[model samples]
Target: IFTSTDQVVQVNGSAATGDMDVLANHTPSIEHIRPGVVEVILEYKSSLALGSGGCTNAHPVSNQHINIVEAAPPESFSPKAVSAKLHGALKVATGNGSEEEKIGSRKV
Candidate 1:
């Protein structure tokens, strides 16, 4: 979703492993990204919401690149809808549900 030649101060992104903050001269590596905001830090910070599929390639010689499979604006989501889903998930998580259901609810 983003391509830049400007100098970056830092970048914050989430992966299946966990969240990570990348800085200039970060070690080269590849990380499988999860669905979350990828914040690019520069003179002014900017962010993009990414879908579940993507990978980050961090190289010392070149800048970090995030390959996004899907993207959507934050405004596209309805807070009320999200809240309702969360409520149901919490109920399943706390109530007498199957083990799989409880674990899945907690993940939600």
Candidate 2:
């Protein structure tokens, strides 16, 4: 989706191998990204989250193209709140909670 030269600091995405971040001057390579958050870190410390989508990085150094199957406007979240939810979900999923509770925990 990068049409112009917008100094990108880093790009984080979920690849087939694993979740990784590509920094400036990163080695040229291709990756099959899975459906997950793609965070683009800009030069001025600003960032943008491209909601869950799949992509392929043909040539990371030069022409970086992103073909998102689905997208949505980014949203902000609190780390503490997210952590709490995760902890609660884990507790329910691992503990002696009901099946319904464990199933619910699987959601965001």
Candidate 3:
């Protein structure tokens, strides 16, 4: 659920093969999702690697729990750059993020 009013708030939704967007009050559905970039658009844009050792156990489970996501540590993942960038973005998101931060989110 990414939003923006004053500070840009973006989220890199599931990049997996079957990732999807489940909006509020939307009908429920099941999917076999994969792991990929989960971006959060903000003053400072960044990326992160998903899953274990560059793979996520995001296999299909239940449609009622699509909100649940899985992510691994940077040390264990291969995309170190993306992982580090994600960390930096989190810091800015929680702290004082700059409006001039890079924009990596897509235009809805």
The 0-to-1 C-alpha lDDT of every candidate, in the order given, reads 0.77, 0.70, 0.44
Per-residue C-alpha lDDT of model 3 across residues 36-94, encoded as one tens digit per residue: 54443346654443442122222233112323355643456567777798987886766
Tens digits of lDDT, candidate 1, 15-71 = 878998888778998999888777777767666564656998888795778787887
TM-score ranking, best first: 1, 2, 3
What clash pairs does model 3 have? 10-40, 10-41, 11-39, 12-39, 51-55, 51-56, 52-55
Minimal lDDT window, size 10, model 3: 53-62
Where model 1 places Cα greater than 4 Å from the true spot, the runs are 48-50, 84-108
Candidate 3: Cα lDDT at 74: 46
Instruction: Please give the TM-score that candidate 2 achieves against the real structure.
Output: 0.55
Leading candidate by TM-score: 1
**What is the TM-score of each predicted model, taking all chains together?**
0.63, 0.55, 0.29
Better of 2 and 3 by lDDT: 2
What TM-score does candidate 1 reach?
Answer: 0.63
Q: After superposition, how far is residue 80 of candidate 1 from its true place, in Å?
A: 2.5
Q: Candidate 3 — what's its lDDT?
A: 0.44
Predictions ranked by lDDT, top down? 1, 2, 3
Model 3, residue 20: C-alpha shift (Å): 2.1
